[model samples]
Target: MKKALAVAVAVALTATACGSEEKDDAPQFAERGTFTYAIPADPGELDPANAVLGATNTVLAFAYDTLVHSDADGKIVSGLAEKWQAQADKVTFTLRKGVTCADKSPVTPQTVADSMNYLSDPKNKATLLGVLIPAGMSATADEAAGTVTLATKDPNPFLLESMTAVYVVCGEGLKDRSVLKTKTSGSGPYPLFESVANDHYVFKAREDYAWGADGAKYEPSMPAVVDLKVVKDESTAANMITTGGLNGAQFTGADRKRVEAVPGIRKGSAPDGIGEFFFHQGEGRAAADPAVRKALVQSLDLNELRTIASGGNGEAATHLTSLAPDPCRGDSVTGNLPQSDPAAAATALDGAGWQAGTDGARAKDGKPLKLRIAYQTSAGPGVQAGMEYVAQKWKALGVETELVGSADAKYSDSLFKNGDWDMAWVPLGLSLPTQLVGYLSGPGPDAQGSNFAHIANTTYDDLAAAAAKQVGAAGCGQWTNAEAALVKNVDVVPVVRPTQLVASKGAMVEVIGGVVRPTSIRMLKN
Candidate 1:
């Protein structure tokens, strides 16, 4: 699905904050003002069902509501549904009374059920299918009882947690999906007021809105209007935050120090996966060969690679998925990944029939071993430098490397559509292991599956299948072992864990699921 295809800015700041006292002195709140923040790129689509960009999710939070919500710590909280219970195969949610859609229509159980059912059907072709919500899942609502129950074809351990990503569309938007491309119809904290394609989007807060993560209610401290500005450059965004041109923005580049030096600015940091490599194991790709994959990994010092990728502000990654509210906290990558040994790498490449020619380039059967390293252009200079270092290492092994850079929005096209990349540095920022099943082990891109890497590790598939059957943490062991299978076999490489930092000025907010929570945004005094 789109979740795994795209790399979201996985920045989680606080679990549950509402302009409370962060210091001994409680900060003053403005009567009512506009809150402006910068998104790394333009949120391409407004429809939550088909889009998975962190920028879109940030904007969607102001207009859409999920069945349930989770705190930064992954604790389940009340959202549209006041109370709910979840089993391995089924989850039932009781709708909160007096909730209304943006159109002023009462939100009924049938509406919620319809939204869930629409997202779960594979025929609908919603990108969230099989990733956020399981495929073939069905939802039924009892109008009289004010309850909606969801049942999946197969048992999903994190079904309840997964619902947090299922943004419920109103009946009108579901009927005519075209209008949703540019408008908002769901019941959230704010509705779309205006949008300018690549510039900014404006939203006005709903005065009557009361439902939020962790039972948060709208207050005067909350912004009357929200502005999401598209600022691609991290240095410009940092400067904006320092000069009070913006309320908040996340930075992963060298410019973060500039913002941190400014006084009275609020900041939050959390781990986000970086420098991860996805080797495209397609038919003719150089990395398709296990020997080549092992040799390539063995040729580099991953610890140094991590430092290069994160600007010396990261640690060796211990797991594949690093998004906050992570359910499974296990070390699947410590001893599983290939060790750094240049001699071993040379031997493996030589044994694979890749011989060095006069030009120091390896050729086998008259075809040279070439690698195309694809990375996001907006991932900062650190990622670019790290990828160049990788290119150099592979070049030392007599393999030709080409650095292919793509924008954040078009990176997926380069990986899936162009099908030209040998390896990519996109990190899958998923909170749960079940959410990674579609991307890591399943039908490949040709069959419309999210496994763009074309990984076919039977051990991973079998272990993942077992993990999917267990309830919640009961199957965490299987999930951990499954992730190890991917690393041990060199299907994917988890390189580094970088701390994602977000700076704020004139406002205080919490970032959940990689975007600022609209309700948690509190306008501060001058």
Candidate 2:
């Protein structure tokens, strides 16, 4: 869902890299315990239909249940729906029997249909429009058969896989969506017990919970209560995890080293999140010029930038989708990006009629080459330093640079609504290539699409359209070509895939796209 940050709109996806291994001397599981964790920021919207940030998804995961479940390796398995069949244009999900909502109401086939229909409707304007469920998709229920069939107007090869992210709201929540802001309704292992904005959220496991990934049932070893506290500072979170104040927390910067030093603390790593760049190619923007965009990318030492941005915890990215279990797995970004050569960048800028003055300032037709760059401050100091480094390199190139750093809310507004930026550090964390289409091609903010960059790469668009029609891994070649087209055209730049690190003190944490999966949590007894 870059409902993962400009999720390349606001979400950033990350997958766990460790903690799935079993050892001969594995720790014993506790009968019951409180599994508390940290979220970097507050998840503003609790409604599953409107969740835009990864933190929101993290919080909602406890209360909501998707139609399908993704296993440790991201394989689609049974969730709320037991058995499912997918097609290019449609998917049928057979609901598991004896499932119930938070209010103890039976989860009928219509319950699932209504949730899907709500997202499909244009009037509802759900955030996951085409990301989770395809656009123009409709749902029909066969109550007698205990199945819900979703038919899409456009062909969607990853329909079943995408449904893993679609959080189905219970009938009561749908009837009065406001209730969702403070409570839970869907059937999950845990139900929302309490919620305090910018503070903490608590969930208690359901005693009779039976349905989970692959028919998993609630056990005595699982946490009785899950407490999610919002800790904005990474250092503080690291400290909390080490001292047993928090059972789990993700560390992305200097604090990561602090937590890893604690010998007994469990950790999971993933090359899921990326520190990518998006240029505003809209009319009148300097980045709209392909030469300028290329020059900007070429001016900086991306390898050094990656090291700085990730606090020396990441490697060079080779594709757009940084999240794990990527359906289209391949290297599409390796040779596509412009190599770092400041001199070549200057030459390219000069060739584009941008002349350098006596003070080394570049201008064209008396208009100085000024560019405004913005990034989400929530990404931490490392990211800010990386953005500042970009400004420094551009300054050497005689370009006037303005850096604006804001939190998620303001940054999201600037990207999708105000459009008051030239270049942005917006990483759309997507596991599937089809998810990138809405952000990189098609209509933009004005048309209610996620193309905040206003990119119009026809080559990429054509390739992506063809790729979307192909079913699953068979379209990897086409998808790779489509992504290559975007990079070659300078519409977007893949910087580095940062390693996402989560440290747990007493609970075994499994992260999916940077958030701890509620079902994968188990209290450990040492």
Candidate 3:
């Protein structure tokens, strides 16, 4: 099926660019060549600690080098640190010598220490940092010995994996945290040379970068230059690929067909992690009813929704940890999750005393079954399609769904934080299980403190806290239990898992290895 699709696309492209043979054979790499890419939206922030989305993290992953990094396979690998040792609750890292930032400041143990402290500090905790580090963890640096010690309140099995996000920014980079909101300054292989929000961004390769992984095969003869141009419309991006103007860009199902039709353009999809809508369980209306929440989950038509939302490109998700590797062996909950059944949904609604009215809308007593769902307009094409599909499904279940779309990006804060919306389509990304602690724990955003979901569960909190302390198999089991609890409780519904589509001009772009990291894009020559 995949091969046939590929062939059909090639045939379509042959007709679109009939006289573009010379451009198809153009040299992919030149001494000072620049490759232009089109991003879907303008990155909200450049600070590694602040970035939450994959696109923003892609830029930060190149601009900043973390203490530890994940390889192509998402395995933990040393980045700025050559080696490290863990003793009980303390992990000591041996900093690599002779490393310097883009500003030419030497990277020392003090720099590592300062950066770690800043990230782990409660005052400076951003969404990324909060997801990376455990609660009550601190770091101490020894410049003379070239080592930085991390002290944890409890044993953390996934500490190294967590460090994959602990980007080591220099002291100069820390002069003003807000400045990093728009600008980037780091010691990674790439440096941000120019940035015109939602228009174009340029990244220049670092000539002095010598601290890459031991066996990593990244050697750019030409000073690698990455030019990212924001193209909101996927059709325009696909058009650029055929015109030989863009090296690579993301595409939708419609754009994918158009691009594949172009003779020399290649179409590919990488696992984009999971994408789902989370209900603010602590907010008004639905906050007081668990049966309604369960009914909502049961009412979803997974198969139909996945088809429409993915445009035949994605799969239905069963758990919060979708597409991620199973951390625990011999665990029954690994792939065991409830499927959608309308009969079950009706039963759940009946149990909650919400009977269908003459208008086909469910109601309890005198109140109608109405819900307001808020979604960000800039989340991407797939999300928009997914939201529409979900809203339609909910309507079929005799529920009134008020669909609200926003572009100012303040919808998430206003809806989730202020409890202004009953449900929202929010995509939360985390590489490891430990990274999900904040979102699952009670006292959520709706609560007084850090809870974003506004739903509280003492049982779920206890299981998550205990699981976080365990390492390896034991830890995985506990985490799995916590995940099961969340699913069974219907704290949040798991919808469709999305795959990222990177459309590029095949003649001018050759993505070295099929290494798809959610946080970075390292392209190579043909």
lDDT of each: 0.81, 0.81, 0.62
> Where in model 1 is the C-alpha error above 4 Å?
2-25, 121-123, 171-176, 357-360, 365-367, 408-411
| Predicted candidate 1 versus true structure: per-residue lDDT over 233-319, tens digit per residue | 888998888888998887777988888888988877756553588899988887889888999999999998999989887778777
**Residues 356-472 of candidate 2: C-alpha lDDT, one tens digit per residue:** 999999999999999889988767788899999999999999999999999767888898889999889865567678777878887788777768899998898888888888887
- Tens digits of per-residue lDDT for model 3 on 22-42? 233434543445667776656
Worst 10 residues of 2 by lDDT: 15-24
Clashing pairs for model 3 are: 13-261, 13-262, 444-451, 444-452, 445-451, 445-452
- Count clashes in each candidate, considering only residues at least 3 apart in sequence or on different chains: 0, 20, 6
Cα-based lDDT at residue 491, candidate 2 = 87
Q: Show model 2 residue runs off by greater than 4 Å.
A: 1-24, 446-449
In the order shown, what is each candidate's alpha-carbon RMSD? 3.4, 2.6, 8.2
Better candidate by lDDT, 1 or 3: 1
Better of 2 and 3 by lDDT: 2
Ranking by TM-score: 2, 1, 3
Candidate 2 displacement at residue 321 in angstroms: 1.8
Query: Could you tell which candidate, 2 or 3, scores higher by TM-score?
Result: 2
Q: After superposition, how far is residue 386 of candidate 2 from its true place, in Å?
A: 1.1
Tell how far residue 406 is off in model 2, in angstroms: 2.6
